[model samples]
Target: MKIVTIFVMMMHITGSLCAQVLQDIKLNAPDMERGLTIMKAFGKRASATSFSSKDLSLQDLSDLLWASAGVNRPENGKRTAPTAVNAQDIDVYVLMKSGAYLYDAKTHSLKGVIAGDNRKMVSERQTNFANAPVMLVMVSDISRFRGDDTEQKLIWAAMDAGIVSQNIGIFCAGTGMVTRPRASMDTEGLKKLLVLSGTQYPLLNNLVGYPNE
Candidate 1:
């Protein structure tokens, strides 16, 4: 009887902990009027070396995601970043202090993936970037491409990931935030943590935050 009672207590505690995990975040609509002109943004586009740990405002975060790859055309469900053959294979996973989330472009919200601060996994050897409030990890599921040529599919995946990363860079430059695109990260660790399949390859990431000035 005592053993059973203890087990029940443990189960209750576990349930409570799971309930405390990060929940889905409904992102705000993209602010079309915000940001600098395209020419000005291009002039200011530069990778950030240092970042502040302050959290981004909800509006800023929403706009950033939308500009990165969110569905710009709701009617056809097209994204801001173009993909080869309209594959739309790139998926953006958000790593923050609270937990990791998968961006659901259809709903314009962040779906909680796991309940932990896995930002370090994305930072890898670049410990300096671990402190950034948010990191966008771009993963490519090559299986989305309708082709038997694995090599060709991989090429298309790389190109699509690069385009999305560029959008992130331009958005940060146009706005006041800073970002740096990187190809380094703990791939194995992220793959396991995110429960990704063999076809899902993590291609790039961007550490975004306010400048550490």
Candidate 2:
């Protein structure tokens, strides 16, 4: 009886830990002027090959997300990146070493989507993106569009996500961090794993990490 009781207790403890939701993280505010200078300085984009194995801290993740698409104007919920018609519907699904999370720009939090290190899933043959410290999967909900035009939906989604991707690239460039953006990803696999709605489309993948220096 004692053994059974101990076993049950262990299961309960495990369940509790598994269910813990990571709270919102406070980000170190970015220097916008510096970022703009870096953006203008990058004459052309480049793909970084090597990366450090260090795990990104919560603060680091928060800063990256904030720079990518966090609310710049809390008074009206305006984001760092613009959306078509201000629909503000793109979701940045983060693939990290600990698990998967959906970045909530409004709350500056990472909403837990699944609990496991699925980072390798985002990598492709062109580059082992899994080695990078972080990857942001840009997903757009087609239903968020103001109209039912399919082509228009794709166009807007790509354009808006491109802006965020450039934000990330510029941030990396300024910080001496390495990065690469890829449009060719295993979108179908990710959709199934993420259980995305039919209208949701994974548009781009952005990889970021410290240079292997």
Candidate 3:
């Protein structure tokens, strides 16, 4: 007769998988000018940094996810990043020192997933993922596409992920956070680890954290 919230059960598994209580919180609106942020991103777009030991707060994590793909126009429910035909298939899953969460763009909140401090497994070993406190794993659910061709859906997914991925870079640059988006992942392996659905395909892993001196 266990009665615990999904988040609590997914943040820590220290002999109590369902011992914690976690829920989504409202994200803080970014306090930067859009045009200025874009300009700054373009300036250092090529000089990306990665592998940092600094960590980000939950609020910082919330802000980054929202900037990357949260709903921008609530009237029409448009996202920060554009999707092909507005499919909006990309899903941003965040890995923090605490746990992993699936970002819900519409609500601008995080849905807890795997429990325990498994964020390190989000990327391959010998990579900079360990240094960064947050890693955004972009996944696209092809079922959202109207088309039935799996191959075509995957292509569209990649394109959609690219746009969202760049948004992370731009946001990090403008906000003074460091990020490095990389495709160096074993898609199938990660899918299994995350227990992703058959139609959901991971696109890229964007590392985010504070810069080191």
Writing each residue's lDDT as its tens digit, candidate 3 over 5-108 gives 76566555654645443445556665445434477667865434555676786667767888899987899999999998899999998877666778888777
Would you list the C-alpha lDDT of every candidate in the order shown?
Answer: 0.95, 0.79, 0.77
What is the C-alpha RMSD, rounded to one decimal, of candidate 1? 1.6
Report the error of model 2 at residue 151, Å.
1.5
lDDT of 1 by residue, 72-144 (tens): 9999999999999999999999999889999999999999988878999998899988899999999999999
Clashing pairs in 2: none
Instruction: Rank the candidate models, highest TM-score first.
Output: 1, 2, 3
In order of appearance, the predictions have TM-scores of: 0.95, 0.84, 0.83
Q: Residue 16 of candidate 3: its Cα lDDT?
A: 67
Clashes in predicted model 3: 2
Residue 141 of model 3, lDDT score: 92
